[model samples]
Target chain A: MINKATEVFVSRGYDGTSMDTVARELGITKSAIYHHVKSKEELLHLAINRGISALDSAVEDERQRTGLTALERLRAAVHASVVILIEYHHSVTLLLRVRGNSDVEREALEQRRKIDDKIRALVAEAIGEGGLRSDFTPGLITRLLFGMVNSITEWYRPSYPVDPEAIADAVTSMAFNGLEA
Target chain B: MINKATEVFVSRGYDGTSMDTVARELGITKSAIYHHVKSKEELLHLAINRGISALDSAVEDERQRTGLTALERLRAAVHASVVILIEYHHSVTLLLRVRGNSDVEREALEQRRKIDDKIRALVAEAIGEGGLRSDFTPGLITRLLFGMVNSITEWYRPSYPVDPEAIADAVTSMAFNGLEA
Candidate 1:
């Protein structure tokens, strides 16, 4: 149901989507949707949280990968982030469009900032370990890194021959090694 | 007038923004707005085109930059592109949010695709010159590159000490040399 809502929200702007639309799309009565969710905002909260929780779990997983160095963890986390973006593509799309107009969106934006801080911390650690470049601030690097990673959601189509792992590899490679020969 | 419209459009989603809102925000009457523009979509067309024209000029400028290698031209173009994003920040923000819901929006999106094609062609030519790594396709590289560049609108504040030049340098540096130590 959340996935269906996300699809509706992504296809139609979030402001343009309604509980009635979701209900009709689901072939259920409006009361049936109201039984599970009081408002469209509730459905948005649930759908957005689906993507947020996946990203949170990825960050937590990277944080606890005991054997890996900061740089390794950062790379793995970028890969994981890309995979999660693909898996939760529509939700992430909706998340990116959020401008904090509502309390729910504001809360989601705060959670997103927390995740960014975590990624930036790992980037700082990698620089401290003398693996990643020290010249660029971790904030800038993390922003650009995820800028590239987050872009995957914009252009990727499921029918394409490129798998998530392949795209992830391309992202990590170009991100670390760059385009220069 | 376009600037004020862009400001309103950026703060309020295009679907939510009306000529009355722009007129109100600009301290003008609805008749005054209609005197200059027929509808809200016309304002969107003007605002979005401001960004598209700036980017088009940047690409055209790079294309004419003589006595430079393909790699150098690509780098310079990235710098100019970043600068335009800052100069036309609100318009670019609105442009990024466009999902081709209207005829004007679809036209804007098509123009945006042409710009992307221009940049991707430069990436390909750079690779052909043996300066860029050929492992990744130009389409992938160009998308990631603009993804990093386009992200500026999300967090950039003019109050920050970081100027557009500094941001552009950081972008091109990480883009070309990457973050590896």
Candidate 2:
């Protein structure tokens, strides 16, 4: 049910979507939807929570937890983020497009900020360890880095034969080596 | 009038914004707004057109025109895009967030896609000229590159003491040299 709601949210957008629409999409009565989810806000909370939890898990994965250099951990985190975003594309898309119009959305936005701060700290750590450049502010670098990864939510489609590994490799390569020949 | 409308649209979102709200924000009568723009869609068109025209001019700037390699043109385009997006942050933000639910929005989206394709072509040309790495697909690289640049619209604020030149230089350097030490 959450998946169906996510699909509706992703396609119709959060503000435009209503419980009635979700029910219609699911071919069920609105009462049935209410039985499972109390309101559209609750459904949005569930959907965004799913996306946030996946991202949090990715950041805390073993690759980032183990004895790795800050740069290595950052790389692992980036790759994991891309994979999770692609794997949960609809929910992530909905999460990214959120505008924080309601209390539930504002809470989701706070959670997103927490994730962003965690990544920013990792960038600062890598720079401090002499594994990444310190010339640019870590905050700026973090925005640009995750900006590229978060873009996967905007363009990646399941119908396209895109290889997740290829995408992860390309992102890490472009981010680390850059595009210069 | 379009500026005020853009502000309302940016704050309340396109769907949630109404002519009544725009007029209220502008301290004008709704009929006064209708005198300039027949409908909310027309106001949206004007606001988005302003942003699109600015972007088009930036892409066609002299720096991208004379005695520049494909890579140089690409760099110039990226810098110009960032600068314009920052300068017109509100309207550009509205343009980026448009979900294409209306005819005017769909038209704006088409124009956006045209701009995106032009940028993608430049990326391909740069790669062909051996100015950038050819290992990654040009399309993917283009998306990531613009993804980083476009993120400026999300966070940049007029009150922030951000120097556009510094931002452009940092973006170019980071895109070229990357984060690795």
Residue A6: error of model 1 in Å? 1.9
Query: Would candidate 1 be rated incorrect, acceptable, medium or high by CAPRI criteria?
Result: medium
lDDT of each: 0.88, 0.84
- At residue B71, give the lDDT of candidate 1: 94
* Candidate 2 local lDDT, residue A79: 88
How accurate locally is residue A11 in candidate 2, as Cα lDDT from 0 to 100?
87
Q: Write the per-residue lDDT of candidate 1 for residues A1-181, one digit (tens) a residue.
A: 7898898898877887777788898888999888998788888999899998999999889877998889999988888898899989999988987889899999999999999989999999999999898877898788888887787777877886778788888788878877799
**Winner by TM-score:** 1
- The list of candidate 2 runs beyond 4 A from truth reads A62-64, B62-64
**TM-score for chain B of each model, two decimals:** 0.97, 0.94
Top-scoring candidate (lDDT): 1
